[model samples]
Target: MAGPNSDPIVSATTAAQLPPGAVVLHVEAGDRQSAEAAFAAGHVEGAVLLVRDEVVTRPMRPGDGRHPLPSAEDLADALGRLGVGWDAPVVAYDRQHGDNAAHVVHLLRLLGQDARLLDGGLAAFTDPVATGPGTTPTAVAREPRPWPADMLPDIDAVAAHAAAGGVLIDARAAERFRGETEPLDPIAGHIPGAVNAFYGDNLTPDGTFRDPEELRARFAALGAGPDAVVYCGSGVTACHDLLAIERAGLGRARLYVGSWSQWCRDASRPRATGPA
Candidate 1:
């Protein structure tokens, strides 16, 4: 299992500091056209664009949130096309902070692959940028494997965790958590009994993640531990908190992928407003 000691985060002042032979990915949270446009403008040398819509997620459905996890076979095929073998070490980054990149890294880690996020993202990367259609290595063969059942919990499991007094963290902005404003989901409040821990708080002002010790302290204040369950509006940004948790040397927390989108769809599952 990958943990904090596995070097789940990396900072590179130059390309030389990046892990040798690692597959570098410029992960974008938007559509393919936008991702390609951004990559074409300029990006880290030898990095390939991994658009969330094209590779990591599937079309949204009624039960699943806005961004659903792709089938194991589909994800394997997408990675294979990018020449990413199961054993290859991967380093993912985005234009700004690593929310999108952390999501990809979280998925990769769950698949038992060695994946890390580039600290501070592109702005902190001092390496020279290369423009135009970047390099595309020859495709490699990959095998499909079931997503590890233990790390991901459905809505029922999340409810049970909350009912049983386990830590349930809502990784949305304070306003959303407090039912003041909701930009995406229809519902404004969070799951009942959930504590608000905005994912952005995991980072420093410059956008790099906080020190592991600091992250440990932050989550501790929220009563979170290894068994904590984390969720966000659509489950995409919640991985930011999970990454921070692991970086804090806390064991990997379970992810409720359905998140607020699915939870809010059913008015039966209780909801709460105001500060947690």
Candidate 2:
């Protein structure tokens, strides 16, 4: 899982033994008690419990997006406690929401860390793993996180990037992306030239990620490669695409944390109506 040509990040059969020197971060959104209990009982062989509020994401700010976009510094500290760094193989998960892992995946990559989510997440781990006691994976590298971002990008930056050949990947449902109905952001339309690749499309029927070759084709069509960028409403589920690209062995991608909320906030930015 260290090289550029590794297989899928998460699979059905393997709960993903954290290799010998890899860091497996098992983060669950909402409520900390359950995570602690699961950890105490047993985890994916070698896993660390990461609470959504405590260590995964920072509190949301008033002008910020609906979902909190955690600061790189805050996540760096979280990584430190979990014995993680730039090259560590991280697998974030959330039992309640099928897409919660996307948030953490985006945050980790924003800090330039090599992180991915368990495809089936908690269900996969429980199915292939048993609770009792597990051993910690060996430590491989400890390189510190990359230079942190001063702040998550707002609408202006997103518009600029969108104009600069970046792929505005919409992680919302098909209806929302097509301006059918939007229960979250103020505006009901999508960013101009944005592609509708619902976050759910990245997953398989069993909740695990789809085949890497399949993801590779979709991303290649969108032109989102190592240098490309992605966005969504409030920048939460957009990470789902980021993780998908990473899992597909395509390349690393960037996140636009503000996403549609910030874009709609500014009337000056362009908006699209029809589906793509």
Best by TM-score: 1
Per-model lDDT: 0.88, 0.67
For each of the candidates, give the backbone clash count: 0, 0
Cα miss at 240, model 2 (Å)?
1.4
lDDT of 1: 0.88
Flag clash pairs in model 1: none
lDDT of 1 by residue, 90-137 (tens): 999998798889899988988888899999999998877889988876
State the weakest 10-residue window (summed lDDT) of model 1. 1-10
lDDT of 2 by residue, 67-141 (tens): 654455665665676677665666666663347666776566555556656667767764455465345534333
Measured by lDDT, the strongest candidate is 1
Candidate 1 vs. true structure, TM-score: 0.97
Off by over 4 Å in 2: 1-8, 12-17, 31-46, 83-88, 96-98, 109-114, 126-154, 164-166
Q: Specify the poorest-scoring 10-residue window by lDDT in model 2.
A: 1-10
